[model samples]
Target: MGSVTTKKHQNGLDYVEVSTDLCQARIFLQGAQIDQFTPTGKAPLLWVSAADDYQVGNGIRGGIPVCWPWFGMSGNGGFPQHGFARTRLWSLDSINMHDEIVDLIFSLKLTEQDRQYWPHDTEVKVLFTLSDTLSVSIVNKNNANYPVSLTQALHTYLPINDIHQLSATGFDGSKYIEFGEGPYQQPNDKVNFDKETDRVYTDLSPVQHLHTPTGIIEVSRENSQSAVLWNPWIEKSTRLSRFKADDYLTMVCLEAANVLDDKVTLSPGETHTLTTHIRWV
Candidate 1:
C-alpha cells in the first residue's frame, strides 16, 4: 500500500505527494491536477513546464488541468477561459490506500466567488489512482433543477524526449477538426508533430500509443468520444504566459474530451464521469 501526506510546497501552494513501491506522484489542490507521475523503473509520464507560475489563482502551465462545464473559449461573453474549476482551490476529500494502488479524491463546489461565472449549484470531484500506471476519473454532479449542456476535457500534458521524435498511432481514418477549421477527415495513417498542431479527433479508439525517442506511451480511456491533440510550436509558445518559447519541444497534449456535437448534458441530480489511463511502455 502507498502512503499520502499533505505539505506546503516551495511555491507556497499545498499539495499531496504519494509514494508507493510501484511509483511516486504529486497532486495539487489547485484543479486537483496530477503534476507528476513516475513509475519505479520508468521515466515520468506527466510533465509540467519549468516556466510555470506556481502562484495561487494562476493556472499551472502543465500536467492535467481539468477543463470543465466548458472548454477553450466558452463562447459566452465575460466567462473565464476553460471554466473556473482549474484556477480555484479544491478540497482534499479523502485518501484511501489499497494493495497495488493509491487513491486520492478531491472535490470543488460553488462558492461566493463562483457566483459571477456559474451561479447554479454544481460539484466537481476528481479521483486519481496511482500504481505502476496512472488513472484519473472526473465526476460532475449537478444540483440545479434544470439540465446544463457543456463540454469538458482532461487536459493532459505528456513528457517527451523530443517533440520532433514523437508520433501517435490509432488516429488514422479518424475524423478531426483543426482548432479554427471545420471538420475534416484524416488522411494520414499516423499523426506526427512538425509545426504547431491543434486538432480534435472524434470517435476515438480505446487505446493510443505515443511514440517518443525515450519510450512508447500508452494512453487509454473510458467513456470518451473526443481526443484533442495540441502542441503549440515556436510561434505560439513565445506568446504563451508562464511557458518558455521552446517548451513545446518537450511536451505534447493528448486530451480525453467530449466536445463539439459530443457535449454532455446532465439533468438535476445527475452525475457524469470521464476516465483516462496512462502509462509508459
Candidate 2:
C-alpha cells in the first residue's frame, strides 16, 4: 500500500496528498464546508454533500471534484456507488506554486485492496492546476495488457446566491437523458431550472458558460463529450443528508463528467485524458 501525507503552504492553505506510483489525488478540507472539491490547491472543485437536512444524496455536490468510471446506484457493476476512487486516498506527485497559480499532480494504481472489488491493473493520474484559471486534467491508462472500461468526471460546484437565478450555456440544443426522469430528451437552447434536473449530454462541442444574476463562470473542456447539470432545489436535497437542514440553499452541482452508460475504454498501453478549465468573470 502507498502512504498519505499533508503539506501546508505560506498562503494559509493546506492539502492532503495521497499517492502510489500508479495513481494519486489531493483532497482539500477547507472547500468541504461549501461542498467544493479539489485534488489540490485551496478552492473546492466540487462539493461532497454533508449529512444535512438539505442534501439530496450522500455523494459529491460542489467543487471541481473527481468521479471515477462509475457513479450512482449500479446493478451491473456490482461495485460500490461512484466506484472505489473517491473514498480511496490519493498521493501527490508534484507541486508548483506562485503568486497567481498553484499546480498539483497525483497518482494511484490498482492494488490488492482495489483489485478485489474491480479486478484490473490500471494507472490513474489526476493533475490540478489552479492559476488565474482553474484546470483539472484526468488521465487513465490500461496497463494490464488488456482492454478496460471506466467512467469519470470532475464534478464542480459553483457559488451562487440563489439557485433559481442561475443558468448555464453550452448544453443548449443538445440531447440528454434525465437522471431522475425516464428517457432522453433535447434541452431547450436557453437553459432554465424548475425542478430536480440530472442529465448527461453527449457530443458536446466545447466551452459553456454558467450565468448567474451576479456573474458568469465559463467552463471549457477538451476530450470530454458529456456534462451533467444538477440541482436538487427544494425537495430532493432534503433526504440525502444527516445533519444540517438548510445546507442546500447555498450550493448546486454542475459536473463535467462521463457517467451511467457512457464509459471510457482503453486498450493495453493506451491512455486517455479529460481536461476542464474554469474561469470566473
Predicted model with the maximum TM-score: 1
Candidate 1: lDDT over CA atoms? Answer: 0.87
Which is the leading candidate under lDDT?
Answer: 1
Q: Rate the local accuracy (lDDT) of all candidates.
A: 0.87, 0.62
Cα lDDT of model 1 by residue, 77-138, tens digit = 98889888898889998888888589888999778878777776777899998999999988
lDDT of 2 by residue, 1-281 (tens): 44446765344445565443323445543321113223232333333335522222233344454667565655565677656666554666786655535566777665687777677878888877654466788888888878998888776766655667777777655667775654455656556676777777776657887776656777787777777776766676666545244555555666667655556889998998888887665
- In terms of lDDT, model 2 sits at 0.62
Give the runs in model 1 whose Cα sits over 4 Å from its true position.
none
In the order shown, the candidates' Cα RMSDs to the true structure are 1.3, 7.1
The Cα error of candidate 2 at residue 224, in Å, is 0.9
Q: What is the lDDT, from 0 to 100, of the residue 67 in candidate 1?
A: 90
